[model samples]
Target chain A: MLIRRPAGVVFAAGLLVIAGGTAGLLLTRHSTPALRPPPAGVAALPVPTGPIVAPPQEQLDKPAPPVAKPVSLIIPLIGVQTKLVTLGLNADGTLQVPSTTAVAGWYTGSPRPGAIGPAIIVGHIDSVTGPGVFFRLSELRPGDHVYVRRADGTTVEFRVTAVQTYLKDKFPTEAVYGATPDAELRLITCGGVFDAATGHYLSNVVVYGTEVD
Target chain B: MRIVKFQLTRWRVTVLLAFLALLVGIPAVSSSAAAATTTGYVALGNLSQTPSPVDVYLYSSGNSSPQLVEPDVAYGTILPYTAVSPGSYSVKMRTAGSSASSTPVWSVNLTVKAGGSYIVVPLRTSAQAGSLQVIDNNLTTPSGKAFVRVIQADLNQQKVTFHCSCAKGTAGDIVTGAAPGTVSPQAAIPAGPWTMTATGPGGVGSLYVPLTAGQVHTEIVISGPDNSILIENVLDAAGAGVAPVGGVSTGFGGTASHGSGVPLPWLALIGAGILVTLASGLRLRRRRLTAKG
Candidate 1:
C-alpha cells in the first residue's frame, strides 16, 4: 500500500531536484574545453591589408630630449661646497626649506633669470647638533669670491659686494630679488644673536654679489 | 509536472527578492553620490579697469596637481566650477598665454564646503608719487617771498615758473605784481598725454600724473628758505600729487648789500653829500687865501 505524502513535502523534493539539475548543467557548460592539435595541411590565415596609421611625424622625427640636471655650488669665501636642491615657495609665500639642510638653491621664477636677477642660494648656518655648511656666512666680506659649477662643465664666478644683516620680518625681498638688468647672486643664511626661546635665527645674513665677468 | 511547478515558483521568489534588494540599495548609492559633489561660484575682485585674460586653477588639499578652469576670461569676469568632495583648496590665477614672467598674480587658500560660494579679492596695482615737497633757496628770498606762474604750453603741458627777487625786501616780503604763487587751472587742462615740466631757478623736473575726465591741472609754489613747488594730479587722473622737486637757498639781500643792479637812494645821497662838502671846503679855502694876499 502507498502512503500519501504531504503536498509541501512533494513540492520541496521537486524544487531540490530541479535546482541540482540546473546547477550541474551550468557547471558542465562553463568547464574549460580541452585543447586539440590542429588538423594536418591547415594553412595560416592571411593578414588583412588595412590602412596603417603612421605615428605623428614630429614625435618620430625628434626623440624626447633628456632633462637637465641641477648644478653644484662652491664658495671659497664662505667655505661652502655642496650640491644644491631646488626650493620653492612655501604656502605662506615664504621660501621653502631645502630637503637637505647642507645647501639650498632657489628655482628661478619667470621674472628672475637663470643664474641671473639675483638668483638666491641659501644654506644652513648650523644643523641640529653643531655648525654646518655656511656657518661663516656672516663673515663673508666684500670682494670675496664665489664659484658655481654648472652641469655643462662651465663654472660661473662671482664677487661679493656687500654683506648685510636684516631682521627676518624686515627682509628686503623686492630690493634683493627684484628686476635687475644684469645677473647677480645672493647667499643667505641664518644670523644675528641666537635666541634660545625660538629655534629660528632672528636675522638673515645676505651676501650680495655680481658676476665676475 | 508538479516538480516543474515547484521550481517555477521558487525561481520567481528569488527574482523578486533580488529586485527588492536593488531597490533598497539604489537610494543609498544616490545619496552618497550627491554628497560627494559640490557646487559653487567664484567672484573675482579688484580687476583692472581694462579687461585682461586670466587663467584660473583649482587644486585639492596638499595636491600638486591642479585642474585648469576657464582657460581665459576678461578681467573682472567671474568663473564658476564644480568640484567633488570639497575641502581645503588653492586657487592659482595667472595671465593666460603668458610666460612665467607673468607669474600667477593671485594665490590663496580657501576652505570650500558642499554648496558654498567663495570670493577672491586681488590686490590692484596703484600709482603713487614719492614725495610732494620741493626745495630751492634761489626761489625763496630772505624776505620770505617768491613768485610762481603756470603756463599751459599745450592742451596738457603745464609749465610752472618760479622766480624769487631779492629787491622785493626781506625773505617774507611779498612782491607787488606777483600772484599768490600757485598756478592751477580752473578746469582740467587737457594736456597731451605727456609729462608736465616744472622750471625753477634750481632746475627743471618732469612729473607724471594720470589725467582723466573732468580733472584740473594745478601748480603749487611754496616760498621760503626751503622753497618747494607741488603739482597735484599732474598726470594721475585719480588725483595723486607729483613729488615736489625743490631747492633751498641761503638768505638773499642781507645787511651787507652786494650789488644787485638796483639803485639804492641812501648810497646816492651819501655820495652827493660827500661831493657837496668837498666843493664848499675848497671854495672857502680859496677865499681865505685871496684875503691873505
Candidate 2:
C-alpha cells in the first residue's frame, strides 16, 4: 500500500467520527422528546423575620443591570428560529398574536427578557398554508434550551421547566400572566384539537422556563 | 294713641325677624360640622429610650385643647395608622394618663395631607431629649412584585445600602444611602425569600425576608437588645398576585384539521443516519481489537 497502515486506520477513524456525528444530528433534528408532566406555578415562600439580636455582616446580590430589548429567538430542540415582533393588547384586551405564522412576537406589556419578571413570547402553531413558527412547540421537553438575542447583541439562555396544554376556555389568567418570584419566560402557541367550525384550536400550549444564563 | 300702638307693633316685627335669623344660623353651623372631613392618617412608633406606655396628643393649629390620639404606647412599638383631619398640628408625647396641663416630654409640628398615611417615631436618647422622624407611608403595591424602603434607625449604622443575597435574586441595591431618620425611596423588587443585607461604614447587618407579590414592606434598622443592630419588617400592604390584562390568541386552524405530520423523507434520512453511525461504531471496535491482538 502507498500509505502506512497506521495512517490508513487513522483516516478511517476520522471519517467514522464525522459520520457518527452527522448521524446523531440527523436523528434528533425533527424529533420530539417525550412529554413530561405539567409543572405547578411558582410558589410563595414564607416571610422572613428581622433579627432579635444584632445581625451578622453579610454580602448580597448586586443591583440588576440594564437590559436591552430582545430581537430574535431560537429553540434548537424543535427547530424554531425567527425574528420577534413587538406585541401589545388588542382593542378587545386580548394579547396580540403574530401577524404571520412565519414569525413570533414578544408582549410589550410584560417585562423584557432578562428582567426580573415573567416575559411573554407568543407564536402560531400552524397557518392555512402549513406549519408555523412554533408548530412543534408541544415537542419541547424539560431541559431544552431557548436562546434570545437582544438588541445589544447579547444573548440570554433559558431552560425549559415544563410544557403544558390548557383549554382555551379555562385559561389560568393569574398563573399564566401573574408575577413570579424570579425572572421567567413563557412561550405560547395553539394546541389540542382544531375546531373546524371556528377555525381555531381548542387549547393553548405554553412552555415555562427560567433564565439559566 | 294710634302712634304709640304703631311703635309697639314695629318693635314686635323687629323681634320676629331677629328670631327667624337665629333659626337659620343654627343649621349653617350644624351642616359645616357634619360635612365630609378632608383627612390624612398618622401612626406612632417609639424607637428611642423613651419610657414605655406614653400618651400621644395632637394640638391643631391655633387650638390649645389637645386630642388624645394614641395612649399607653410602649418602646419598640409602632402604632397602626389613625385617622386625623388634614391640617397643621403638633404631636406631643406625655406620660401615660398624664393631665393635659402637664408639660410634654417630646413634641413636633406635624402637617398632614388629605388621604396620605404617615408614621412618626422618636429617635435617639429618651423621648424628652430626642427628635422625631416622619416616614411617608403612602405607597402602592407593585404589580407582580414587592415594594420596599428602609428606615435608618440603627444607633450606629449612619448610612447603608441594602440588597438581596441569593444566586437567583435580581442584582443591585434594593435601597441605597439610607440614613438614620430618613426614609429611602421606594424600590420595586422580586417576590421571593431574600437574605437582605445592609452595608455601610457604620457596620453591616443581615436579615431574612420573604416578600410576596403585591406587597409593600418597610425595613426599619433599629437598635436591638444590648445595642446590637437589628432589622424589623413592617408590612404596609399584603394583597397577593397581580392584575390580569391580557391572554393568548395564537394560530389558525388550516393545518390542524388534516394534520400534515412529519414527512417520510425526514424519517428515512434519520434511519439511514442511525445505520451509518452503528456500522461505523462496529468497524471501529473491530479495528481496535485487531490492533490489540
Candidate 3:
C-alpha cells in the first residue's frame, strides 16, 4: 500500500535538504586551499648558543658537469614519439604545462634526463576539443621503455617502475622533485573525473621510471 | 813533503765540514716570515681505534724535524687547528709517550693550498691498515643564504638522511645516503636557525645550527653509544673567494694577528735539528781519524 505524505511534512523535508546542501557548500568553500603553513608550535627553533666555529672559506669544490637539454621523447609501448619543449615554474610556483596539447615538455627546474636526480616531464591528457598527448599515459606498464633524445646527440633510456594516480591536492612534491642517488624520471598528466563546474580535473596520473643501462 | 801531505789532508777535512755546515744552515736562514704570509690552516683529528692516544707531527719533504702539532690526541677527539705554511706536508702518527726519535706507526703526505682551510682525519680501516683522509672546505654560498653539506664520517654507520626536523614540506632532504667520509652536495638554504635530524642505524641524532647570512657549513656523522648515529656541526669558510676580514682567523682556532710575521716554533726546531745532526757527524769523523792514527 502506497502511503501519501502531507504537504506540510514534504515542505519541511525539502527545506531541511536545502539547509544541509548550503552547509556543505560553505565547508567546501572554506577548505579549498588545503596546503597551509606550519603552525606556531612547529615553527623553526632558534640556533644553539655558543661560538660559531665554522671553517674558513676556501676554493669551491669542482664544478659539476652541465646537464644536456632533452630534444624529444619516445615511448615505445604507447607508440608515443613527439618533439619536446621547455617548461618553467609558474607564478604560483607550480609546474607550468606545455602550450600545445600534442607535445610534451621537460621542466627546466628539474634535473635533466640522465642527470643524477629525478627529472620531470609534464603533458596534457586532453584538450578542449579532443584527446591530447599522454591521454593513455596511465595505461603504461612496468618495464616499458622510455627514450629521451638530448641536444648533446645522446639518447637516454628509462624503464617504467611504477604508475600512480593521486588527487591534485594530495600531490607528493618532494618524492617527485627530491634528489636521488641515480638518474630517474617522472612523467605526469591530468586524469580522473573532470568537474564541469570547476573546469578542471580532480586528479593527476604520474609515471615513475629509472634510467636503464 | 810528509808535512805538506798531512796539511793537504787537514784542508780536505775542513772543506768537507764546511760543505756540511752550508747544507744545514741554508734552510735555517731561509726567511720563514715570507712563508707565513701565504699560509693555510690544518686541523688533525684521531678517529682511529688502533692508537688510542696518538701524537701527530707535520713535516715537509726537505725538512728533517717534524713539528708536534697534536700531542696525545685521544681517539674520537680533534686537536685544535694549527697554522701551517701552504705547501705539501707529510703527517707522521706515533703512539703517545713515544720518544721524539721514535718511529711513527702511520704516515701520509697531503698538500694545502694558499689561503685555504682543511681537516686531516686519520681513520682506522681495520686492525692492520689505517689511512688519512683530507677534506677541502667549500665555503661559498648564495648571497644572504647559508649552505650545508652533511657527511657520514663514522664508518660503522651505514647511511643517514639529513633534513629539517619540523615536517616533510618544511624543506626537502639536505642530503641522503651520506656514506663514511663522503660529502654531500651543498644545499643552499635561507639563513636562519635550523634543527636538522639524522636518521641512521640503531637510532636518530639531531643538531641545531644557526646559519648566518652568506655562511656555509658541513654536518659530519658520528657514532654515539649503542651504535646510534649523531651529527657534528662544522662551519665551512665564509666563501670561496671571500676572505674573512676581522672574524676568527682561518683554520682550527687561530688567534694570531693577521699580517704579523710571527716566527713559528716549528721553523726554529727544524733549524736546530739540522745543526745538531751535522755537528755530530763531523765529530764522529774526527774520532775515526784519531783512532786510525
User: Of the candidates shown, which would achieve the greatest TM-score relative to the real structure?
Assistant: 2
Clashes of 2: 6
Ranked by TM-score, the better of candidates 1 and 3 is: 3
TM-score: model 3 vs. ground truth: 0.38
Query: Can you give the DockQ of every candidate in the order shown?
Result: 0.00, 0.09, 0.00
CA error at residue B81 for candidate 2, angstroms: 32
Error of 2 at B238 (Å): 15
Compared with the true structure, what per-residue lDDT tens digits does model 3 show for residues B1-293? 34534653674465446445534533221211121124466767766656768888888766879765568876556543465777888888889888867888777888977646676767654456557777676444464566677766566766777886433454658877765556567777776677888887657888887665445566766676776776776544432111111111001102111221212333343344434434443444454456555
Model 3 misplaced stretches (Cα beyond 4 Å):
A1-213, B1-37, B124-130, B165-171, B239-293
**RMSD over all Cα atoms, model 1:** 47.4
Best by lDDT: 2
Candidate 1 per-residue C-alpha lDDT over A65-105 given as tens digits, one digit per residue, 9 for 90 to 100: 22233376766534466776666555554565565456656
Arrange candidates by TM-score, descending.
Answer: 2, 3, 1
Model 1 C-alpha lDDT versus the unseen true structure: 0.41
Using DockQ as the measure, the top candidate is 2
Cα lDDT of candidate 3 equals 0.59
lDDT of 3 by residue, A108-164 (tens): 756678754467888887777666767667777778778888887667888787777
Please provide TM-scores, in order, for all candidate models, with all chains considered together.
0.30, 0.41, 0.38
lDDT of 2: 0.64
